[model samples]
Target chain A: MLVNVLNVISQWAIPLLLLIIPLYGFIKKVPVYEKFVEGAEEGFRTAVRIIPFLVGMMVAISVFRASGAMMVLGSLLKPITDLIAAPAEIMPLAIMRPLSGSAVLGMAAELMKFHGPDSFIGRLASIMQGTTDTTFFVLTVYFGSIGVTRYRYSVVSGLSADITGFLVSLYLCHRLFG
Target chain B: MLNLIWLFLLVSGILVAAWHGNIEVVTSAALQAARDAVEVCLNLVGIMALWLGIMKIAESGGLVNALARLLRPLMVWLFPSVPPDHPAMGAIILNLSANVLGLGNAATPFGMKAMQHLDQINPRPGVASEAMCTFLAMNTSCITLLPATIIGVRASFNSANPTEIVGPCILATASAMVVGMSVDYWFRRRNRRRRR
Candidate 1:
């Protein structure tokens, strides 16, 4: 019963925001169409700028996967993650989570295919994907676009947060679904 | 740091593939990944345009400022270096709120704008300011209320209950946000002490 309500809310959340914000703009007598076009023009430019970074990261991820490096890394980290009650199969997803969204999305799809989306590993992967942002990607594109060279402390905090998210996802999945 | 990671990924991947006699796999993968990258960017274009357009209307209508005002107290505490009335503050607030609402595409433009605003007031041109680091930390660990993308993927995969992970996602993100903020605070304090 509770799940149904939350699901409904989540479904409506984005649509409502899209509708209400524009309505609010109209009410305020703003030139909504012009402003939207202006912002979207910037968005198009930003999207173009991100292509190089996206390709670089994606190619690297592909190499990591095709070369079996991802599996090897996952194996190497298995004992440690297992000791902490995390399934080793999902380790690569956790590592890739903060790096590239598309890479991790692909990983999640693979995991769901192999383990079934209802499986514990699949659930954990889904939660991990949802909870964490692409840290390195964001830093690169956002900071790179603005030319912020020295990203002191940002990487540390970002990765730490990712670790926390991973651990929490594991714990929550185990407790809630296991 | 990013350079090292990139280098490691490329070298290790190629080395490992060579050792396994699967060099062809690496070649094919790279080509496929390049194509995928273009596809991903193209997918983002529509989403980005839609969200950025909506966000612009919100900005012009003063909705962003109103939302920023509501979040100002907490934001001021988080970004002490930034003035209360600064555009950066509003941008950051809008970015975070967008993120929380699971508007990743919309959030990116706002986040980019926030970074630009933060950069305008940055004392050191190239070096990231304390405020920027804090903002980045928060952005990276922004608490997500709805894992919309994940749920959609799960549904596509025929999960019995697609939204089952949502509860856990929120909890996990909340924890991440707390840890991120704490680490940012620690780093800020330590950096200040070093200067003294």
Candidate 2:
């Protein structure tokens, strides 16, 4: 019931605000268009600087997968993962969260193909689908942009959160659904 | 310096933990991981380029400007320190828009520009201003409306409705932002108390 109301409110909010802001800007002759252009130019350049890091992280993730390092890590971490009841299907999400999108997608697709849709693993994969933000990747980009040299605490905190999700979700699946 | 020690400690821990089970395999795998990393880097070359090209065109065609205007209110609320007319606010809006659409690939530069703009207004030369920390918190935990990459992957694997993940994705991210903001606020407040 609440979600429906929130959704309804959201549907109108952006459109209404967009209409009102520009109308106000134009009436005041605020040069709204040019100001927007100037701001956006900075946005464009900001996108460019992220290339090297993205490339590096992508390469690292690919190497891990290609060399079977990730599999090894999976095996090494098996005992812990089993405790959480994390199926092999969602394991890559654990690894890939700190990595990139394409890498995770590759893993997700492989899981879907190998484990059959609607199976336990499949549902877990589905759950994983909507969950998780790229914690390390996000921090690297945002903190690095601002030249944050001492950003260690958040790294530990974010990874702990991911681990928390892993443990709880695994417990839920095994005890209830699985 | 200290980070190197930490990395060393981590690597050693991994080696020690996996020693009895398959040390040699783990070692070889780590090397292989490095090699695979290079290959993965090659694969992404094209995808990133295509996205950047689209972003470039968006900039040239004034689509980015439209995006900024579209997200202005959210930007204002997020970065209350930056004046409404500030270029930083515009950059921030665009950065956030890219993030909302699951375009982390596109949002990096905008994040930088937002910081650069924030930097100009930094009253403290070395320390991050209150607004800057808040901006970082918001960006790091920016709520994603669509988990585009996940949806695409689900679709690639032939999910019935790839976009269904959007609901869960939005919920998770919004909650994360709320938590993130509260923590950030707490830290800032603590810092203020200390200064006083």
Q: How is the predicted docking of candidate 2 categorized under the CAPRI scheme?
A: incorrect
Steric clash count of candidate 1: 0
Error of 1 at B144 (Å): 1.5
Predicted structure with the largest lDDT when compared to the true one: 1
The 10-residue segment of model 2 chain B with minimum total lDDT is B1-10
**Model 1 agreement with the true structure over B14-74: per-residue lDDT tens digits:** 9999999879989999999999988877887777777778878988898878878888899
Give the alpha carbon lDDT tens digit for every residue of A1-178 in model 2.
4334434554564456456555555565556666555545544444445445444444444444544455666778888777766765577666765455455655666777788444566645654544545665665555544555455345544544454444544444455447
Off by over 4 Å in 1: A1-11
What are the DockQ scores of the candidates, in order? 0.67, 0.16
In the range A97-175, model 1's lDDT, one tens digit per residue, is 8877877998899999989999999998999999879998788777865777688889999999999999999888888
Where does model 2 exceed 4 Å of error?
Answer: A1-89, A152-178, B1-77, B123-130
